[model samples]
Target chain A: MRWLNTRTITPLLFMAPVLVFAIVFFFLPVGFSLYISFHKWDSLSPPEFYGFTNYVYLLSKDPQFYRTLVNTFVFAGGTIAIGIPLALVVAYSFSQSRFQTVWRSIYWLPMITNIVAVAFIWKFVLNDAYGMLNRGLALVGLPGPGWLTNPSLSMFSVIMVFVWMQLGHNMLLVSAGLQSIDDTYYEAARIDGAHSGNIFWDITLPLLKPTILFLLITNFITGISYFALMMVLTEGGPAGSTNVTSLYMYNMAFSDLRLGRASAAAYILFALIFIVTLIQLRLFRRGGVEAHN
Target chain B: MADAGGIVRSRTLGSRALTVLKYTLLTIGAIVMVAPFLDMFFGALRTVPERLARPPVYFPQTPQWDNFAQVFREMPMLQWGINSLITTLSVTVLQVTSSAMAGYALAKFEFFGRMTAFRFVLGAQMFPFFLFIIPMFFILRYFPLVGGNDIFGKGGMGLLNSYLAIILPFAVSWHGVFLMRQFMMAVPSELLDAARMDGAGEFRIFFTIVLPLVTPGLATLAIFVFVYQWNEVIWTMTVTRTAPNLQTVPVGIYLLRGAYVEEAKMSVQQAAIFLSILPVMIAFLFLQRFYVRGLTAGGVKG
Candidate 1:
C-alpha cells in the first residue's frame, strides 16, 4: 500500500522540470498576453490600463487590420485547398507505386530546408529584372508579372511557397493513411467492377477522413503562423498586402513597440484559432489527443 | 483468342495513359520543388559577369566547387556551424528529456490537475510565439538573478546575447510533450504492472522500461526538433544581435546576405546559403528511415 502511494510522487518528481518550465515560459506568457491586451503600453512608458481600447480600435478603426485578417484566411484557405488534394493524389500514387521511397525523399527536401533560405532563393527566381520565370515566360511570348513585388500577385506568391514547403509532409501523411487501407477492400471493389475513381470516392476518401481532417486543422494553425517565410520573401509589402496576422503581430510588437496592441491582436488570433480548432476536433475527432510511443 | 488479345491490348493502352498523366504531374511538381535549388546552386557557381549579364546564367558551364571555400574565407562559416550545432543540440536534448518524463506522467499516472495540465499544454501549442517576442526579449535581457541589478532587475544583461538566451526560452515545447505522452499511452499497461510486481521503482519503470519502448517515437521528435532548431532565424536575430559568436548558421547566412557590398560577393552569399543548408540536406538523405517511421508512428499515436 505504501509503495503504491509512493509511485505517484515519483511521476510528479519526474514531471516537475517540464511543469515548471511550462508554467514560467509558456502558460505565464499566455496569461500575461491576455493582461497586456487591455493596457496601453509601449516599451518606453509603463503600461496604463485602457480596457477594451486596443480591441475596439482593431475592430472598427484599423483598416490594415481587416486587410491582414482577410489575407491570412485567403493564404490559409488557398494553400490548404491546393495542398490537401495534391497531397491526396500524390500519396495515392506513391502508395500504389514501387518508387515511393525515392519520391518521398525528393518531395520532403523543401520542408526541412530553412524557410528563410528557400524564400531567398525564390526571391532571386522571382526578381523582376532577370528571374527565371520571366525568362521562360518571354520564351513562350507571355508576360511575366512582378511575382513578389507586385501587390496583386504577392499573396499568391507567398501561398505558393507555403504549399511547396508543406506538400511533402502532407503527402506523406496521406500516403500513410492510404497504406492503412486493407488491400482486400480494393480487390472486392475491383470484383464489383468499381472504377478507380469510384473506388477512391467511395472507400479511400471516407476512410481517410480522420487523416485529412488532422491535416486541415494542423495546416490551418500552422498556416496562420507563417511569418517566417514572409519575413524573408516580402517583409509584408510593396504595401501591407502580404501581411498575415502573425506578421502583423510581429511588426506591432517589435517594429512599432505597440506591445499592448500586439498582445491584443495575438489574443484575438488565439481566440479565432481555438474556436475553429475546437469545432473541427468535435466534428472530425482528430488531433485532440496525443498519438505517439 | 483474338478477342482476348484485343482486350489485353486496350488495357495496356489505358495503363500507359495513366502512367503518362502521373509522370506529367510529377514532372511539374519536381520542377517547382527543384528549380529554386538549381538556381541557387548555379548562381553560386556563376562568375560575377555571368550573374550580372542581361540574361543571367541559367546553367553554369562548369560547377564551381571552389565557391564553398571562398564562402568559408569570407565569413566565420565553421564558427556559425559550431554555434548552431551547440544551440540546436542543447535545446533538442533538453526538450526530449523533459518531454519524455512529462509525457510518461500524462500517459500513465492519475494525478490531480492532470487533465488541466494536459489542456494547458495543448492550448499553448496554438498561441503563436511571435506575440511574445518583444516582452520575451526584454525579460531575457533584463531578468533578475545572480547578476547584479536593481530590485526591478533592469541593470545588468542577465541572459541576453548568450547561447543560454537562444536555448532556454524555447527548450520547453508543449508539442513535444504532447507527442511523447501520446507515444507512451500506446504502450501496454501490463508492462507497467509487471514491472511493479517485480519490485521495480517508478524511476526504473520509466527509464529502463518505458523509455526503451518509446525509442522510435523519441527518434522522430529528435529529428523534428533538430531540423526546426537548425532553421530558426527570427528569435536568433532578435536576441543575439550584438554577439557575432553567438549567431546560429541561418542568422549568419542572413547577415552575410544583408552585408555583402561587393558585386562579386553575391556568389559568396549564394555559396554561404548553400553550405548553411547542406548539413540538413545530408541528414535528410541518411535519416530517411527514422524520419518516415517517426512521422507515421507519431502520427497514428498522437
Candidate 2:
C-alpha cells in the first residue's frame, strides 16, 4: 500500500550516501584498479591490454618486487615479535599497578600522536652522533651504532620505533583482554597452591591466547602494509633495506608514475595480506572464536 | 613488637616484592613512552648553536622559548593549521552524520537487500586503502565537471588541489557505519513505535529520540574519526603533493623536510612539530575514556 511504499522509499533515501560511497569509493576504484592491472598505461596515454604481464613481471622478473616483499614480511614479523610480548607484559603489570590513570595516559600518548611526528621524533632521538639514545650510550662507554643511516640496522630501527609508538595502543587492547579474563580462574589456581610462574603459564597464558592472536594478526597486517615511518625516516634508503612492498608500491605509483604496474603491486600485496589473514584465522580458529565473543 | 613486625614482614615479602617489581616496570615503561615527547619539547626550546654542537646539548640551558612563536614566523603554519582543522572537522561531521543515518536504516528498517548492504559494508572494509590509491587518484583527476574538467572528466586536474580532495575520500567510514549500527541496536524499537503511534515521522523519531540516546556512541565515533583523520597523512600527502595550499600540518611539516635539514632551523622544526601535535594531545587528555570505551567495546580499529 501507500504506507509500505513510504517505508521502502524512506529506507532507500537513508541509504543514498551509502550507495554513492559504494560506487565512487569502493566499486569504481576497485574496478578501475583491476582494469589498470591487466593493462599497461601511464595516465597520459590510453591503456593497452597486456594480459598477465604486470603480474608475471612482478612475480618473476622485477628485481625489487621480491626483495620488497621479503622486507615487508620481516618488518611485519619484527613488529609483532617485539611489540606484542612487551605490550602484554606491561599490560599485565599495569592491571595491578598503582596510579592506573597516570601510567595509561603516559602510554597512550604515542598512540594519539601522528605517525609523521612519531617518525621525526625518533629521527632526532636515534641520530648517530647528536641523538639522545647514542649520547646516553656514550655516557655508559658503549658504542653507538648508526641507527637510521646504516644499511643493516635500518629495518631494525624502524621496527623498534614502531614498537615504541605502538606499545601504548597494544598495551591498552591487551589490558582489556587481560580484564575480560574471569578472576575465578586466578582464584582457583591460587587455591591449588600454584606458584606465580605456574599460574602465568597454566592459566593466564591459555586464557590470554585469544587476545594475543588478535593482536598478532592485526599488528602483522598493519606492520606489512605500513611504510610511512620508513618513508619519513629513511625514504627506503640504505640500499633499500627498509623498503617494504607498500612503500615500493607508493613510490611506483607516485614517483615513477607506473600506475599500471603499481596497481598490480597493490593487488599482489593485498593478496599476500589476505592469504596470511586467512591462514591466521584458520590456525587460530579455537582462540579466534573466543576473540569474536 | 619486633617479633610481630618481623613475622608480618616475612609473611608479606614475596607479595611486596611482586608489587614493587610491577610498579618499577610500569614506571620505566611509562618513562620510555613519554621520554621522546620530552626530548621534542626540550629540543624545541634549545638554541640553534646548542642543537648544532658536537654530541649536541641535551638540555636547553637558557631555553629559547622564542622557537615556539618562531614556528609561525618560519612557515605557513597558521594556514596549515586552518587546513588541518577544516578538513578534519568536515570529515568528522560527514562521517558521523552519514554513519548515523545509514546505521539507523540498517538497524531499524526491514527493507529488501538490507543484509546485502550490511554485508557489503563489512566486506568492503577488507579491501585495504592501499589498493584504491592509484585508481582513486586518476578517478578524482578525471572526475566530471569539477576542477575545470569537462563532461567526460577530461582536460583538468579534477578534484586535485581542493579541500574536497582531502575530505571526500574519508566522507563515509565503513567502520563508523558498523559501529553506529551497534549503537543504534541499543535503541529500543518500542520508543520508535511509540513515536509512530503518536504520528511522528521516521526522520523526526530519529532526530529527536534515537539521536539523543546514542550521544555517547556518536561521541565515541567522533573521537575515533577526529583522531584518525587529523593524523591521516598518506592519502592526504599523495593528493596534496602539488597543492601546498591544501596541505595539513603533518603533510606540511613532512614535505617541508628540506627546511629542517639545516642545523639552525632544526630547533624551529622541533618547535613546529610540538605545536602541530598539541591539539590532539589536548583532546585525548579530555576524552580518553571514550577511546578506552570504544576499543574495549567493539575492538574498534585505531
Candidate 3:
C-alpha cells in the first residue's frame, strides 16, 4: 500500500508539459539566437560564420548602438523618476481615503486599456496643427511644439505616455503595500505626536520599501522595453530620437534583415538588463534580509 | 492660556486647509488619468470632418452611433476579435497549467539539478521579448513535423503565421512558473503529510488541497497572461500581416487608418478602434474584482 502511494509522481506528471515547453520553446530558441549571433544570417540566406565580427562592430564602431542605449536609459529614467513617485502619492492618498477602491480602479484603467488605442488617441491629440494640445495652447496663448514629430520632444512625449500607462499598476502595488502595514503602527505613531508629514516619512516610506523596490525594478525592466508605443506613435522617427535598444533590435532584425547584428544588439540589451537587475538585487537584498532576519 | 488657545485655533485652521488641499490635488490627478479616455470616447463619437476640424472638436455635434456598425462592415473585425479571443484564451489556459505543474514540482520535489534549473529559468526571464522574436520567428517557420520535410526543417513554412506559431512558443512563462512556485511553497506541508498518511496519491493531494488553496496565484497568472497576450502588439505585428483576416485587434485597429482620419471614413476608424479594444475593457470591468485581487496577491510577494 505504501509502495502504491501516488504522491511522488504527481509533480512529474504535472510538470511534464512545462518541462517539454521550456526545452522545445525557450531553451531551443535561445540557443539558436546565440548560435545565429555569431553568423551572418539573413532571412533567406543560409547563415555564414562571422565569428565575433558582429559583436565587435556593434560594440566598437556603431554610434547608433550607443545612441539607442542612451535613449533607452533616458526614457526609462524619466518614466521611473516621475511615474513611481506620482503612483506612490496617489496610492497613499487612496489608501487613506474612503474611496480607495474607486480611485485605484480609475488609476488602473489606463494600464489595462489597449496601448494601440491609447497611442492613436495621443497621436490625434498631439498633432502639431490640429492637435488637442495645440488647440488648448492656442486658447491659452502659448506655443505648442510638435509633440511626436519634434526630435527634442518626441522621446519626452513617449516617456510621458509610458509614465501614464504604468502609473496605475504601480499605484495598486504600492497601495497594497500601504494596506499591509499594521494599523497599530499608525496608532502608535499618533500617540507619539507624529504629524502627517512625519507619519508618511517615517512609517509609510520605510515599511513600503519592499513594494517600492519591486515597482522600481519592474518599471525599469518594462520601461526599457518600450517598443509598442514607439512603433505606433513615432515609429522611431524624427531622426531616430525615440529609438530605444529594443525597437532598434526589432528593426534591425525584421526590417533590415541583419539577423546577426540584431542578435548581437539583443544580447547587448539583455546584458544591460542583467546588470541592472543584479545591481538592484544587491541593493535590495540587504534591506530584505535585514527586515526578515 | 491665551497661547494654548491660539495654538488650538491654528490647528483647526491648518486641518481645514489640508483637507481642501488634498481634495484639490486628488482632483488634478484624477483629471490627468480620466481626460485621455474621455478624449478617446469623444473621438469615437465624432465624424471624420468633425475629427479634423480646425480647432479639433472636443465634443461631437452628433454622435456617430453607426460608426461601430461601420467598423463591422469595414474589416474582418469580427474575425480579428475571434482571433484575439482564441489566442488569448488558449495561451492563458496553457500558461496556467504549465506554470502550475512546474511550480508544484519545484515546491514538492527534491530532484537533482532542481535549484540549477530554477535559477536558469529565472535568468531566462530577464531576456526581453524583442531579443527572442527573430530567432523565435525562424524556429517557428522551420520546425520539423507532420508534412513532408527534410530533417533540415524546410518544406513549406512549418509553424509561422499559424495559431500554433503564437501559442506553442509562449505556452510556458518563466515568471508564471516562478510566481506559482513561490505561492505553492507557502502552503503548509502538514496538509501533504496528512494526505500521505491517508495513503492518498500525490496527484489526489495536489488536486484536493494544493490546487484549491492556490486559486489566487493561478488567478493572478491567468490575468497576467490575458492582459499581456491581449495587449501584445510588437510580436503579433511582426508575425501577422494583411488585415481583415489574420490580424489581432491591436494590429487590426492599427491598419484602419492610412495617414488621416478622413482617409479611412472617420466614423469607421474610430468605431473600429473602439470595438477593437471593447472586449478587453469589458472583460477588465467585469473581472475588476479578480484583477485587483490577483494584482494585490502578486505584488505582495513580487
Best by lDDT: 2
Every candidate's DockQ is: 0.53, 0.60, 0.55
Local accuracy by lDDT, each model? 0.81, 0.88, 0.79
Off by over 4 Å in 1: A1-5, A285-293, B1-9, B146-151, B186-199, B261-263, B298-302
> How much does candidate 2 score in TM-score?
0.96
DockQ of 3: 0.55
Docking class of 1: medium
Assess chain B of each prediction and give its TM-score: 0.90, 0.95, 0.89
Ranking by DockQ: 2, 3, 1
Interface RMSD of candidate number 2: 2.8
Per-prediction TM-score to the true structure, in the order listed: 0.93, 0.96, 0.93
Q: Scored by Cα lDDT, where does model 3 land?
A: 0.79
Q: lDDT by residue for model 1 over A40-93, one digit each (tens)?
A: 988677789999999999989999888899988998898998889988887777
> Across the candidates, what are chain A's individual TM-scores?
0.93, 0.95, 0.94
RMSD, one per candidate, in order: 2.9, 2.6, 2.8
Q: Pick the candidate with the highest DockQ.
A: 2
- Stretches > 4 Å off in candidate 3: A1-8, A289-293, B1-9, B146-148, B186-188, B196-200, B242-244, B259-264, B298-302
Tens digit per residue, CA lDDT, model 2, B96-193: 99999999999898999999999887767777888989988888899999999999999889998899988999999888888888899999999898
Query: What range of 10 consecutive residues in model 3 chain A has the weakest lDDT sum?
Result: A284-293
